[model samples]
Target: MQDLEIIASAGASFRPGDIPPPPDGGIEAWTQVAMGWIVIFATWGYVNSFGSFQAHYTSTLPQSPFQISWIGSIQVWFTFFGSAFSGRLLDAGFWIPTFLVGAGLQLIGIFMMSLSTSYWHLMITQGVVTGIGGGIIFAPSLALVATYFEKRRGIAIGLVTTGNSLGGTVYPLVVRALLPSIGMPWTARVLGFINLAGFILVAIFMRPRLPPRQTGPIIDWSAFRDTLYVSYVGGLFFFVWSVYYTFYYLASFGQQEVGMSFADSSLITTIINAVGLPTRVLIPVLADRIGPLNTIAPAALCVAIVAYTWVAVHDVAGVYIFSIFYGIASGAFQSLMPTGVASITTRLDTIGSKSHWGSYLGCAVEYTLRGAIGARESFEGWLEGKD
Candidate 1:
């Protein structure tokens, strides 16, 4: 329940040379860190729970998969796109306003979704509004993790990012259970209330380690001129593309190609997410010891290979194996990305003046869109017997 003002006040006391060493055995420090993780989990949970909503919307609306998909797509797009903007704001020490605006947008979007009666309504409410909201909420979580921990940065990031996996697991089951009883509108309304509560908790507890004035952009445009940064960005593009595609399509693929029942397919998706929860925590720890990119490259390659191989598998066992392996690999890739970015941007503090977090995040989102397009194309091809 600590406020940003309190965090800032504490941070302000430290001079450049007096910056306190990372705290040890301090329950307060741990609590602050935990609160940041909670915020991340809440935000990411909403983000990853899209599959649950996607399934329900597809079933209930039937005429609007395209539109419903937009809800998630836009959420993700804004999540990444908004990061660019929010990152800069966070760097500029507007943590309180950032959190408030994000929480408000998310709450409004959820309420709006509850009233939606058509595809366009969902698109505007869920896609644009909610997407924007989620994006704002997500930015501070990532930025704060970096500010808090240096030695265990990878593990910390991974732990926080695992919230997406946990959300993916829990939200779907909630939707699946509620859909047959309360129906979509009520389910959405209930979800809105839940999001409101979660965001309130975030506003109460999440705080930045650095003072507002000392906090500035960690992102640098000139870094992109470095071949290593370009490679990292390009690699991340493909990595995110593959990650989203697998998440979006794995269930459908199981049902269609592996002959799994709908219940079974849903279970498979849940299992994949569940398995990812641990990987989200573990892989980053490993990356911390070895190297993030070194770890990420292999993990990504494995995902691409295993994902394609899933196309050839049959029955529950094959799909299950694919789901577990692919999930772990994909989860590792997700955990390592930010670390990879951080590793390349080591001079971030010095280069803060020229930082354009928005532009960098915009590039990442562009790649995400490209990935989504590729997934759609693959789905279309599969439907047409091309794959």
Candidate 2:
């Protein structure tokens, strides 16, 4: 928090030309980029698959939609909330401890989730345990990935961000495949093993290149006065709220309202993630040359357009069309966010505060939006009105 405030305060006074150059590319740097990518793949990949669980639970459990959503909401919210402290820890050079502990807890959480038979059980295991761990890992994956590249940072971070898209894209299919024969418990176990493998590699390769910034007052509160930071944070708050709410609930919406089979409904998630994969990578490359914010605004606008189109859809064809357009637009928004934040911040020490932690603060509001949407009675009536 103070880390970002101080940086935002400093960056507010500096000209863009004064920003220092990064190594841009080196063997070690790209290697670290790979490490960041893998951690994101495991951490976010797990969270991104929650739409599958959300849809499945709506049918199997007696829990209301609002109640079932708490598990996923908690899981995702912690990923944002925990990162504020984890970002500080990374700045303090505690990467190894943070990474390993997060991996262990995440694995345990995934395994524990497999045993869940009730709402509270899932809320504790998947929501609390795994969510906290995911947040811890998520901080560095965004923060550290930036330390290695500057000129092409948009694409580099974009590549790592694709972990969100790729994991979302692939894990749904993996869970769908495993659920029939192996069931949820064994299926979760398989994912746990994969998490162990991916994170082990991250543990070995992920290192903090910069020494800890221990001398400061921690976070400077005054950075909130910076207009750019304020605008950036405010914009993302509403943007992510809508994106997350839509993606998380989309499968169940397809199933119950659109008459998609469980398999077909689940496939909506797969398609959204799949369409985002290439867009995540390629769009950031565009952001690099054209500018991240310029790249982000148009894409963000398109997301708004497609989201409105979601209501008009009465069949799979309309859903697919919405998925394709929304996926590309939202993918650009996700991939460009770090780049956009970093572009304005002149200091490395505060970059995490400005980007990861700042966005986390913005994300808290999303839970409110999600909770509103989670209440199926009201949300369904709204959806019915759309028809």
Candidate achieving the largest TM-score: 2
Give the whole-model CA lDDT for all candidates, comma-separated. Answer: 0.64, 0.76
Cα lDDT, model 2, residue 77: 82
Q: Locate the minimum summed-lDDT window of 10 residues in model 1.
A: 347-356
Which residue window of length 10 is worst by lDDT in model 2? 5-14
What value does the lDDT take at residue 84 in candidate 2?
61
Cα lDDT tens digits, model 2, 299-382, are: 889888878877687777887788788878888788888777776665676665555554566568767765665555645565
Off by over 4 Å in 2: 1-21, 217-220, 372-379, 384-387
User: Which residue pairs collide, candidate 1?
Assistant: none
Report residue 349 deviation for candidate 2 (angstroms): 2.0
Counting only residues 3 or more apart in sequence or on different chains, how many pairs clash (N, Cα, C under 3 Å) in candidate 1? 0
Reference-based TM-score of each model: 0.82, 0.91
